[model samples]
Target chain A: MFDVLTRILRTGICSEPLPRIETEQAANLQQRIWAVLGRALCIRQVDAGSCNGCELELHALNNPYYNLEGAGIKFVASPRHADLLLVTGPVSVNMEEALLRAYEAVPHPKLVVALGDCAACGGIFGESYATRGGVSRVLPVDRVVNGCPPAPPDILRAILEAAQGKRQALAAATAT
Target chain B: MAEFNATPDFSGAFANAGALPSNVPCRLIETSREQWLRVAEALRAAEGMLLALWGHDERDGGQGFLVYASYLTAQGLLVARLCLRNGDERFPSLARLFPCAVRMERALHDLLGVASDQDDERGWLRHFGWPREFFPLRGENRLQTSFPPTPEPYPFVSVEGEGVHEIAVGPIHAGIIEPGHFRFSVVGEKVLRLEERLGYTHKGAAKRFQTLSLAAGHRLAARLCGDSSVAYAWAYCAALEALSATVVPPRALWLRALALEHERLANHLGDLGALGNDAGFAVGLTQFSRLKEDLLRLNQAALGARYLFNFVQPGGVECDLDPKWATDLPRFYSHLDTELEQMRSIYDEHAGLQDRFRGAGVLSTATARRLGALGLAARASAIPLDLRVDYAIAPYDRMRTKIVTQDAGDVAARVVVRFQECLEAMRLCQRLLEQLPSGDIHSAPRVAPSGALATGIIEGWRGPVMVALQAGPSQSIRHCHVHDPSWQNWPLLEYAILGNIVPDFPLINKSFNLAYSGQDG
Candidate 1:
């Protein structure tokens, strides 16, 4: 316990900035997220046949530097409880059905973010005997984070953008 | 123990043993189908572990189909090539001798149409989407762009007798990890059996390799398994270099070692943190994760990418070490060394962690040996089957690598190995960066001639990642077989889970953390 306290004290808080509450862009992020989701954002990450480059970045979001949960955004176990479906990979045929099921299970007015080059646009493993090519082919994606895997900051920005986009879509629907 | 160090004694029906172009001495035997089983039998008797088994369609070259079985023996590396004539596509299965060959044979059948004469005809990589008629690897077949997936019932051997219930977990798991299904048969919380149905992430990496040039293929190999990206990239580069007989600059080799060690350190730190989290220790995750992030930041500063993807290239590294890394890396390492020691003591004295870790999910050395998981998986179980030590090449050959071994084959032992290996890797990395040779970081790219065959085997974080490349005419790749050590160790997890509770499954699984993408392809 003494060792733990000493270490913790030395470490201090490592969470980078909550920027305008964020990478790539962070303006009006925290307020926008709160106004939209009310309390927090629940993401269900679906790896639709990724090289796992994107997955590593996604995991990094939880690390102290990114502190995704600290920003009131967290990954849930089930799609049923999720507001956003964060998908990665080129959507292999084997994973196609699973991706669709997860998409369908997510509560309505859901936002989808394609998290890597492969997920955004069949990065390398293009249309072949196995892969179906990109997340947009099967699901409606609001934001596509590009890179071999867009850095964690970029991933967070994509997530925030996805939430903002969904809230706008919801507002437009109600106004109409 | 010394027997494993000796090259395989292939003394029987196969007298003609030639060598393949590789950093390590690898004898090759291309013989008739009749001697296929005999070759495996010889190697098995000689205590050789099957390295990789792959079948490629060479009918375009006016020859019959060929299946190659690479084995790591006492001698070094030995590759056995089985030739199946045009009309005859059946070859005897190595599954009888090497149980690990079962999945390889099934996957070979799925990708290339060569049928392994094995009783377990169940599909390995083939879910309903891939029809039996369409063999993706065989370039001759005119395939439809998309095959709409259909459901096919997989026969998971059911457990019986009162109160034995089964739990099915998915291809879309609960975490930010690659997709694969897990079927757990349990009586209450006690797990009876754990059978994995992988290949959900088969992005046709092998099939896609056929479409890439000898130069562009390393990029794809790097992604074969994301976590072990550098190792795969280096292995692919090593194979291409071997085929072309390109002597990579000494500095380039040292830099490649730097990237590989960074990869090793990063993975170990990540896993150690996760293991702590799995054991309900939040502080472990926070501290180790912070340390990993620091290392990743250093990697980005030094190597250009956080994950070190595409950092290794054919005959060289993609980037030169940034000069600032000298003080920056050492400072980071010093901080890490101190922090790691503190964390280790905290973990060691924490009774809760010790109780959960001590006897949970044990895999015996004998079982690991019998099952042919003598490399990465066996290392923790007091078996030193490290490729860096056994088949030392390049920087590893020079660095006198420290191979950490633990007698207990439990999660605790694996954790211990990770901690020790991380420190050793740090020391090696420091040496590599400090004494980085004065020369070009890469050699001039030379195209490997057509029909050149070579294998590159490296000790990845998970286990040995082997890439076997057959050069096609004018820089085209005929076949590139990427073998992950996960193939041998994933099954070991099934044994590791037996008698352990279902609740502890995640911790055990995390400890081994087999690559689904690497093995699936």
Candidate 2:
């Protein structure tokens, strides 16, 4: 215990602050979110058909560097308790119905964030004999963070923006 | 040709038992339907491991359904192909002899409409969403079709007794993990039995492979399991190069080895940290996760992607290692070694953590062998089988790779094996960086002729990942089967969970860390 404590003291505060949102609108929207929820956000993640790559990055959000929970955004076990649904992968046919059920289970005004390229635009594994294209093809996605597997900061930003209800604006900005 | 030693007279059953296409290490034996079971039995008797079993539709020609099984032996690999004539879809099931053949046979039944004599006829890979009549991978139903949203409760096996209850978890799990259902039959937290139902992430990767060009197939292969992207891409490229009869540059082989080692290091670090966290040590999680992030950031800087996807292409790697990476990697390893040593000591000194880890999930060697467990899981059980050492292809053949094994077959054993492997991978990366040859990183591969078939087997971080490719006319892929070691290791998870408390399942499962997407694909 003494060793652990000394090690901690030596390491000092290695915890980095959450990354800043670049866009002014998204930053303003995150401030509005702070006003409404006061930094507490419960998220539930659903894997529609991902390759587990996105899940790896999502798990990294909990690391000391990103420390998503430190920002008061926690991933809950059940959809019923969540305020946001962070969906990944290109909705596989097998998981489409389950994704829908999860979306419906969440309370009203729940924000849905589509993560990774697969969830955004189907990525490489497009609508096929086994998939129903992207997450938008099945459920309404408020925010889309695009990357094969988006970096943790990008995912965190998208979650914050979605909580602020700036998904449409964020999408419009990315479009331009 | 090596003389036939142990068999039920191969000369009578096979039309041709010699001369496989380029790059396939196995000898192709075309067999009649009657001779299929006898050959499979003889091979199993000789202790040959059933590597893969897949089906192909040859109805366009006069032949009906073609089924092939590849077996790995000490001598080498042997592939047996059985042809079922028109109107005959059933074949003798090898699952009765080799228990691992059950899932693969079921997959063939789902994709190509082939029937195994001993099959339960229940849906395996094909979920309720897919129509029963439509066989997706067959030539006739190759095109995309709209699937109806049919949500059916899977028929999980039930255990009935006084106070014997069943706990069902997932398709969607609590933590940020892949989707798979686990049905545990427990008597007050002591697990009686555990059954895993996967395939929630099946994305028609095999069917999609048929639509892609040989070059594009590598991208799809890399995505088959994202964590082992480099291994899968290398295997795909190896298969393509073999089909095209193209030899990758020496420098390319060394670079590929370096990337593979980095992947191994990153995954092992992540798993070690997760295991520590599961044992109630958050310090391990924080430290290891930070280290993993640093490694990923290094990968992004050097390879252009955090996961190193699409960095390995046909005939060689897609890009050369940056000179900066060459300088930074050795320095990074030196720093990592010191920190990792301190962390290891901390973990060792923690009595509570050791108690949680030592004997939690014990998979005996007998059980692991019976279930055909592969990769780190197998190594933990003292099954000394590693493709890099046994198969020894390209750079691995030259490197003095050390095979690590632990006899305990428990969570502690798995942890130790992972630590040893991570250290070895670090040493390997340093070696590859220092001894990298001077040459081209890529060579433009020639187009493979139609009907060409090749196989690539790489010892990925998890285990031996196998890719078998058959080229169509005009350089398109006719079929590509990407097999992950998870297929062999997943069954062992059920056995590992037995008698352990429900809470420790995550820790045990993370120790194995089988890829759901790879298996579902």
Candidate 3:
């Protein structure tokens, strides 16, 4: 009865942003709170030639757990409308040309976020003849989020950071 | 052997299509451009779709290189081989006959520096970043150099109108995803055209196959696309097994089907969650994602790899379902059923999800068939070609499946098919577990008999994955091609996104869910 009542209460409360706020506070610092709450961002995604593991996590951002739009960020289908380009995969041979073309297509004032180890410097799949090691080889990267395919929460945090433009500074200043 | 009497007289049928001279028995048809059209027409009469088209450097007594085309028929396989001498690279383009032929020709041009009058000048598969004139697959030019130089400006087509600004997304995405370029010509909220440029995930796995032993080759297949490892491995093994004529044990066959369906279920679960989230339905996403995670955990526990790598080897399976899987499967099914019902309600009752999914990214049956869309997308759009059904392979044939379909071929129909297939898969898993047979898990696969060729097709989670293997001068892999259905459907994604609002592209893309890694290879 308590679980049922809690679920009903929770579902109702979800519409008001409290549950998401509760979850967001745990993952982000108090200073970063306004970063997520204040802005709705359009994301542009790039893939050098990833294994699609990162895609799985990217797909998760839209799921109820991360509900990025609920947090005020949206994934715009094209780069011209995008505020950020999220990159996954190590750049591969066939994709090198296409990747650069896509980067050039996006409008100015756009932020670039590298989403995985492959994007950073050629994760496990880097050594193959098909890849060029990392996405940075193909395009400029402003922020790096490391993981095989970072968890949905981590991706959401990266987007939030891009939206706020605050968390990357912390990582850089801390020198971690 | 009386089997010798069954061989058809190629002189009468393919003689006009460039049947080679008597001395060149190893070489088949050297089809001319005019002959390619005739050959395609003839093969169409035999009911075969053009599987793939690509070039290989000349080897052994074989001259310059060969361009190959494959046709599938109920009786057996038919291959049309066109030899392209190094300097004389011109060949008739089959793109006019088969729409999917355009991209294959472009890939040939990009990789081998080979061109044909049939080439699609739209640059469907050309490199935008790499040196423009330098072809990667030409054997003499294997060295990586910075000089050939990428094209200075990519020439993607744009739409011009008031409020029509172009939006380009990716080669690099913010999320952990494979690289592909999505160019949207949009007017405020409305999308006029969506052009997708992929092939960033190309690993040259097909080219590397020549160096790999059959055992190691399976590893390469599994890595072609990570998520569909089992399907790729199975397809590769199937080609090798058919070439070798190895008879796999029945129990192993059943288990293979079970694993394939399990793979299908895992992807569908994850997709369902994502699709829901695309609709702005958080509750559905949360529930389905939790469900998908549970399924992944189950996969990790059952197979050493969550994606079921190396579990499938040529001739038989590498691992058996543990005793725990048999026991735990029922409970898992029940859990899945409960969660599925919950999701169904959310999808059914929710108004927003319907608005996003109903008619968005619609790919009609005609368009899907014309584009050669394979797998569930094709099936959902009413293209009744399931390898398990059409080919009637073991386990799938015996354990009948009511093919799930929806003619709408829109995003909603895809979701409906996916959701329905999930339920059916769960039921099938339950049945397979109950009817589990007792037998050895592995079998000794056959070594190829000399001068044999075979093709294997498996309906992977994504679509029909076809792998063709031909035995070379010494029973080695002479030439091979791995065909992902993405080859057919990725082009269709451009059409599906047309007229959809820009914001709906993700929902549309996720609905088709083609793989860049597999297709690029």
Per-residue CA lDDT of candidate 1, range A82-127, in tens?
9899999998899999999999999988789888889888888877
For candidate 3, write residues B89-144 as lDDT tens digits: 77778777678888888887777777768634655444554555666566655433
lDDT (10s digit) by residue, model 2, range B1-521: 23333545643322235655433355677666656777777666776677789988888877888899887766556677888886689998988777888888888888889889874677777788788878987788854677785655567778889999989888888878888889999999889889888888989898989989997899999997989999999889888998898888999999888889889999999999999998888888888998998899888888777888878889888788878777898899988887788887888889988898899899999988877788899999999988888878778787889999999999999989988898889888888888889889989998898987888878899998888889999899988888888888888898998899999999999989899999899
Which predicted model would earn the best TM-score?
Answer: 1
Candidate order by TM-score, decreasing, is 1, 2, 3
Please give, for residues B1-521, the per-residue lDDT of candidate 1 as tens digits.
01121234445322347778877867777655656676788878878888799988878677778899998887778788876776677888888899999999999989888888899888888898867678888877633367767788899989997999999999888788889999999999999999999999998888888888999999999987889999999989888999999999999999988888889999999989999999999999988888888888878878998988889988898889767777888888888898888889999998899888988989998888878885556889888888888889978888888889999999999999998998998899888878889889988878798988998988888888899998998899988999999899988999999999988999999988889888887
Please tell me which model should have the higher DockQ, number 1 or number 3.
Answer: 1
What is the C-alpha DockQ of each candidate? 0.77, 0.67, 0.29
Better of 1 and 3 by lDDT: 1
What order do candidates take by lDDT, descending? 1, 2, 3
For each candidate, what is chain B's TM-score? 0.96, 0.96, 0.89
- Candidate with the larger TM-score of 1 and 3: 1
DockQ of 2: 0.67
Candidate whose DockQ is highest = 1
Per-residue lDDT for A54-137 in model 3, tens only? 777676566554566676667776677766777777777666665666677776655788888778887655544456778777
Query: Of the candidates numbered 2 and 3, which has the greater lDDT value?
Result: 2
Q: Looking at model 2 chain B, report the run of 10 residues with the lowest lDDT sum.
A: B7-16
Give candidate 3's error at residue B394 in angstroms. Answer: 1.8
